[model samples]
Structure formats: C-alpha cells, structure tokens
Target: MAQVASLFTLFTHHAKTFRDLVYSLRNSLLKTGVFTNEKVAEQQVVSVINFDIHLRRDADGHRYIERITECVPVEQEAGYPETFRHKTTTEEKMTAFMETMLEYFRRSTDRPLYVARNVIEYRDGSYVAVHPLSERSRKEIAACLAGPDQAAFEAFLAVHWGDSDEN
Candidate 1:
C-alpha cells in the first residue's frame, strides 16, 4: 500500500514538472520570434499520461502506455489572454488576428515534438513504458504545420469530407 501511494505521488509530480518544463521552453521560443509582441498565451502541445500497472505471480509488475498524439493548442477553449493585446496605436484588430495566426504557426510546429512520459526503466532492465508516435499521426502533424491557419485547414477538410473521420 505504501509503495502504491509513493508511486501515485511520483506520477503527479511528474505531470507538474513536465508542464512547467514545457511552459518555460515555449516562452523562450515565443520571445525570439518576429511576432513576439503579438500574444500573451501560446499553445502547448500536451500528452495525456495514462499508465497501467499489472502485478505478476512473481510480484514483478509493469506499466504500458498509448501512442503520442499530435499537438493541439494549449488553451483551445479559453483562447488568448488580455496580456497578448497589442500595445502600439497602429495595431488594429485585424493585425492582432493576423499576429495570432502567425503565433499559432510558430507554436504548433516548433521543437520538442513529444512530451516524454514519466516512466523510467528499473535496475533489472525492465521498463514501465511510454508510447512513441505512429507514422500516420506524424504526417498529419507535418501537414498542419505547412499551412497558414490550422483552423482554416480543418475547415477545408470539414467542407470537403467530414470531421468525424479521423484521417
């Protein structure tokens, strides 16, 4: 029981640490961009860590995980914060919107593609593992980054085919 409790604590801490690490890296990237002045909040691609532990007859247990999903905006529903507001008098609403589009591009395609799961291999050379991305999802991610607007790209797809289809 104590071991299980300790493991849970470790897992939660892993989530917080991962979130902070990604946030720091993202802030650094946005600052260096040409449109740095454009927005306050940037999208963070997140991975949901779902871990399963199974105990064997020998009392040796292991964990398994799902594949890495592509990036989605950090605050998809909340949108940008007030801090992203334009400072210059010359900046118009449209400019802000365009700046947003640009910011989205910079974030959605930048470095640190995968958020590694917290699992670590034990001394016995056995690992409670995490997933690697599949080839199909990787290609879709690339295609999304290649376009100007992600929403527009999705809209184009929706118009032609349908949203229910994953591919």
Candidate 2:
C-alpha cells in the first residue's frame, strides 16, 4: 500500500470550554514525538507546531483536529536519495504520531473522545483533506450569531479568523 499523510478529527466531552480544549490539546501534542522538538505556537483557537502540523478547533466547537502534514524542502533534491536520513521511515513516523495522540486522549480524560482518521489527498495540484462541517454544527453556529451575545460571538470569530480589518 502507498503511504500517505493522515488527518485526525478529535472529539472531547471533557472540554467545558473551547479554551480548555485548546490548552489540553497543545500540552498533549507537545509531548508527542512529531512535535516534541518543534516550536509550538499556541493561539486562542489554534496551535501550530512549526509548519508541519497544526491543532485547531472548528468554528462551531463541534470538531477538533491535529493535522500532520508533509513539509517540502525549499531546496529540491536533484534525484531520489539512496537512503532515508532518519532511522524511521515516513510511515513509521506517522504511526508513532497517531499512537501518541491516541494514548494522550485515552489517559487525559474519563470521557471517551471520538477520533476519526482520514488519509490526506493531493488533488489538482493541492493538498486536501475533506472535513465537512455537519448540518447540526452549522445550525448551532448560526443560532449563536443571531443570539443576543453578539459581542461574545464576534470575539470568538476574531480569535479564530482574525479581526475583519486585518483580513
């Protein structure tokens, strides 16, 4: 079988708030092999480990993900290398990354978190991972936007998508 990158969707019931979830995920990912040596930047709604991986929460607060991506080197090699520089192959690295995440989630909370894995695709000259937001999540988000707490809702949007002026 051909090896490919994997993206995981994480669902947690222990997270009472979005901030709590982001914090937990950041700490957990830092302990993983893939992110241990990398610089992890934690924001209000997203945490990025270098440029190779990112952990973020969906807008509706119904989905979370730790995305592991393949980084292309700026200086391209002329030809295929004779052997891998690292002892572990790409597949092995991905396996370890997945295992570490699963173990962390298992031990972090009493409530079981649903984890779904999907292989990333390179289509039409772009990398793509299909993560369709559910209709329920969409309705919930719309309700929030239409509700009285407009200030809080706008704050949430600013944190995730940045301020409108900046955009």
Candidate 3:
C-alpha cells in the first residue's frame, strides 16, 4: 500500500519526556503482543529512536515546544580503563568494581534503557539549547540529507557540537 511521507515521523502522545515515551511504548507493544520479550522490545525502540520533543500550552491556549530530548544509548566506550586493569591487589580490584557499580547505580533510572538529555529547552519565553547532539546521531542525521541542506546542516552541527570532528 502507498502512503504519504514526511521528512520525519510524527506521533501525538501524552508522554511527558523521552523516558516516559519509551517506557510507554514498550509497555503498549508488549501488552498487545506486538513483542513478547521486554528487553528485546526496549532495545528495538531505543536503537531506532533519536529524540522526543514535548509541547506545552498556556492558559490562553498558546502552545510552545517545551523541550527536545535525545535518547542516548548506553555508552560502552568506557571499556577497560588502564587504571582499572592495572589494579593487581584483591582490595584494589574490589574497590574498583564497587566504584563502577556505584557509578552505574547513580545514573540508573526507572527505565535504564537510555538516558534522555534535553538538547533544546524553552525557558523564559524563548527556546534555548541545553545540550549538544551525540556524534552518532549527528552522523545519522547528516546521512539523511542532500545538496545544500546537507552542507548547511553539517555546518550547524559543527558549531552546535563545538567540534569539527562531530560533523
């Protein structure tokens, strides 16, 4: 079947943020038998998703975008730190392992699949940037563009990310 297309997909949902939206999506898909395994379904959602934007309204019914959040995948780049690998003593290894666990616990959320960061936020009657896009997302977005737009968006990303390598 043929269907109309847009530059990006859109869905009107009651999710308050990226985290909420992902959790809701997983639950809905599982409950309806769209997917059976919780872990697999969550990974599917997070792996394909990039950002979620929330909108807000005032008493007068004027609507504005509240925030734009990116769904950050679990970063495994930490790998094996030299210091951690060099720990030869049992006590040292125990402490290192404990520290790693502590760090994980600190960032753990109710839905620990992804960490949502607000890349853009509305504040004081204006929209402002809060965080920059991850390099992976930047590259993915760039790959979807062409011609002048590709060049222009790349420039914006270079400046926004504050790193030429990111674009």
**Per TM-score, what order, best first?**
3, 1, 2
TM-scores across all candidates? Answer: 0.23, 0.22, 0.69
Q: Stretches of candidate 3 above 4 Å error?
A: 1-8, 76-111, 158-161, 164-167
Candidate-wise lDDT, in order: 0.41, 0.40, 0.74
Across 61-100, the per-residue lDDT of candidate 3 in tens digits comes to 9999999888888753454333555699989988887787
Tell me the deviation in Å of residue 116 in model 1. Answer: 7.3
lDDT of 2 by residue, 19-100 (tens): 4445576566566654652223222124221122344555676433444332111212234323334437898666666666
Give candidate 2 misplaced runs (Cα > 4 Å): 1-10, 37-167
Candidate 1's clash total is 1
Cα RMSD, each candidate: 16.4, 19.5, 4.9
Across residues 101-155, which tens digit of lDDT does each residue of candidate 1 receive? 7767765566334433433323354543223323344345446564667567556
* Best of the two (1, 3) by lDDT: 3
> Cα deviation of 68 in candidate 3 (Å)?
1.3
